[model samples]
Target: MKRVAIFLSVLMLVSASLSYQFYGLPYLQKVDDFTLTDHNGKKVKLSDFRDKIVLVFFGYTFCPDVCPATMLRIKETLENLGDYKKYVKVLFISVDPERDTPEKLKEYVNFYDKDGTIIGLTGTPEEIKKVARSFRAFYEKVPVKDNPEVGYLMDHTAYIYLLDNRGLLKLIYSPRKDNPKRIAEDIIQMIKLLKMEK
Candidate 1:
């Protein structure tokens, strides 16, 4: 019996290690509400999305590669979600508040999201800083030396944060590492768990 117990313990450890390697860690902390301007030029609070499984991504529309790729992956994730997509909301928070106006954000997100599920958000520099700090998301502006016309670029964290329907952050995924199918699966799983809890 002791040998069997030891074998089960080893199995559990291996399973957990594999899960973490593939899916990353789950964070179950409650996220505080913050208000930011959406693409529609309206003040929107984070708590407004309490009924949705929110996927928060901090990036600028002018980002040459990472931002667009991540948004496309998020589009693919919503596609994978199928009918459950209605229960999800994607918030694209701009780290570059100077250039990404409400009008520009509306155009940028609409190009990627035809169904209008992805909402682009931008605010004053201080407001952006506060929201970024709350999520532990980092962003910095680097002047473009080679191109004078390009002006500058933003260096920012690329993690996609997942919050449950109750507004508790649950998981963080890397666009370069995690696939859309896996992300969709995790969202569905969280939705199921929330339903079960009720």
Candidate 2:
């Protein structure tokens, strides 16, 4: 009976420990850096957000559907962050640099920064292409539509990438696979993991 009790205790301990185990996180790979113009027309580097958890998505102001939905979720996630909001940053990179001027980007990105922490970034066409390529995010313009009020649309990869405070690519949330609450939960977990590491 004593031996059986010890084995049961060990099993319970192992099972409890498993609850804290997070298996999918990889040691984040280093990302190439770039300097781009922010919504404020200020030069910003990808490194600027170091020491903070950063969320990134490549989108354009003219986007009809995906961009708005993604931005809304990001806004909701930020709202759900509570006290951790200070340590989080969101970077919206405009894929259509030609039409997405710094001013336009500022308006678009700020609209989603419910807490006023998000940054909108844009640059020359070449610069945009370089940043997009580094992120492995695809974007391209389709032919213009007949409606004069609306212009051509861009088909882009709908990926929300999360980079850790140490500038490591940490997690990715996709619209189909994740909702805002889930995204916020992952971020909270990452923040806790980082705290544990420190």
Q: Highest TM-score, which number?
A: 1
TM for every model, in the order presented, reads 0.86, 0.83
Per-residue accuracy of model 2 over 1-198 as CA lDDT, tens digit each: 645644554454355336653222332445677899998899999898877888889999989899999899889888888887788889999988989998998888877774458899999889989988877889888877687666678899888888876566656676685477767777777777567234
Q: Write the per-residue lDDT of candidate 1 for residues 1-198, one digit (tens) a residue.
A: 645644554454355446543263565455779999999999999999888889999999889999988988998999999888988999999999999999999999999898778999999999999999988999999999999999999999999999876666768997566689889987777676556233
Point out the worst 10-residue segment of candidate 2 by lDDT: 20-29
List runs of model 1 lying over 4 Å from the truth: 1-24, 196-198
The TM-score, computed over Cα atoms with residue i paired to residue i, of candidate 1 is: 0.86
The lDDT of each candidate is 0.85, 0.78
Candidate 1 lDDT at 7 equals 56
Model 1 error, position 6 (Å): 31
lDDT of 1 at 13: 35
Query: Please, what's the RMSD in Å of model 2?
Result: 9.0
- Choose the strongest candidate by lDDT: 1
